[model samples]
Target: SDPKAEYIGTEPWTPKEALEGGEITDKADIFAYGLTLWEMMSLAMPHLELLEGEDDEKEVEEDEDQSLEVSFDEDAYYDRLGTRPAVDLEALGNSYRRMVELFYLCTEGDPVRRPSAAQILQALESNVPLNINPSEVIVID
Candidate 1:
């Protein structure tokens, strides 16, 4: 891990490598960028839907002298589940499908599997399909 590459962002935006205290690389940036794009398209905070669902399951008690306490292990959640922010590519429209595809590539659990900034740019510019197996191309009839 690079000493200077510490990430201080919120849990939802942090990558698996960063969550595991592993070496932070540009791939971490790609992970955060993907979530940011999701936020922009959905007009909502990342992981908010999941959190809200969890919130509904818990009961809160109000008291004049009592304080509310909340505890959540974001790192543990990622370590155990390897979950990503939910996205509906179909709802985002055809223009955004390409970007959503890139989002999945950027957030890959294996940092090495994630695409580099150059590759992402090239795919975007060339309108090439971004897939794990490049040999497998989808041909729409």
Candidate 2:
């Protein structure tokens, strides 16, 4: 399944829960971005720890209403990637830093506050001056 296509919601909700119904908005996409960034840095997802046990052949044979796994709020992607080595992000240089920052900005909590894809693309296209090398900020366990 496409990770981004996954739904996230529950009723009688905890603070951690979100309303799963209705539209897939840019906010949803931004949340996905935050999840993605955490994945990139942690070399895994925020909470999930194991690879998915089932496959396409063993796909859940339930409708949305009948499905329990339909809206898992956990960070399953980090588990899917398995063990990964630490990355010294500082080594990426200034250009790479800009790119990662773009990822973070794209994933900001407020969808309205995050930059649009067009803005991101424009930033990438624009010739901006750099001071610090982006490749130095490292990420580890």
Candidate 3:
């Protein structure tokens, strides 16, 4: 009767703490919102890379008219800590730096460091830059 067992295969939008069976908070929503923003900007599914290198094998199997059942390795995928979808900041252009920073702030690995919904709204409304350090920006294009 483990509480965390139910969360083993949660989606990529889930925050690290949730995946680790930690307490859920409002910041979890912020983490999900950050992934949503990444999805919108990248026009790609989050954590699709988890299936990387398997596509070719599946294609070959399909071409042979064989029954192909692909299974997602959730344990392997979730074991890699701090794995977030890459955001193509360069493709997004220079105009979106602040927004990108906000995305990073929202998805911070430590929930305690994540900005509250109110802080995010205030930054968006006033166009004020976040005080996050550059080293903290882990999402790479």
Candidate 4:
């Protein structure tokens, strides 16, 4: 089963090509890495922790509707043209926030738009803080 369907929604971590049943590439791993990086920075919340343990048939149905609604909202907010993650700005500070922007690039809706793992590694190696303007900051996925 496509776990994204039952749980996490079509998050930035999910490759758009995979969702469309197209041929996926190493970029898919990069997409997942963006999400994992967010989770690691955001206190390690389990993927789809909100919908855990609703295995009963009845519960599943009920949860599905609610999940879809939440998923939709999340999708809108976390999308490339929408918002970003819900990390603690005060705690993470500006540098980490800039990194979030880079992660966002990794999760681009078009697989081709996403940065490769090697590019991401090079960016990380530069050791330069992203320094995104706070006014342009968006919400979390």
lDDT of 2 by residue, 1-141 (tens): 233454443211101112323234434444455455556665654444433335633223466687544334244443322122233477655655755666555544334555544555566688453223223222111
Per-residue alpha-carbon lDDT of model 3 for 20-72, expressed as tens digits?
77766666777888888787778766775434454555322343557674555
Off by over 4 Å in 4: 1-13, 46-91, 128-141
- lDDT per prediction? 0.68, 0.43, 0.68, 0.54
Location of the lowest summed lDDT over 10 successive residues in candidate 3: 132-141
Candidate 1 lDDT tens digits, 60-109: 45667788644445665555433467788768889888778888887788
All candidates in order of lDDT, best leading? 1, 3, 4, 2
Once fitted onto the true fold, the runs of candidate 3 whose alpha carbons sit more than 4 angstroms away are 1-10, 50-76, 80-82, 131-141
lDDT of 3 at 63: 38
Better of 1 and 2 by lDDT: 1
Ranking by TM-score: 3, 1, 4, 2
- Model 3 earns a TM-score of 0.66
| Poorly placed runs, candidate 2 (over 4 Å) | 1-24, 49-95, 127-141
lDDT of 2 at 42: 53
Q: Which stretches of candidate 1 lie above 4 Å from their native place?
A: 1-5, 50-82, 131-141
Candidate 2 versus the native: TM-score? 0.37
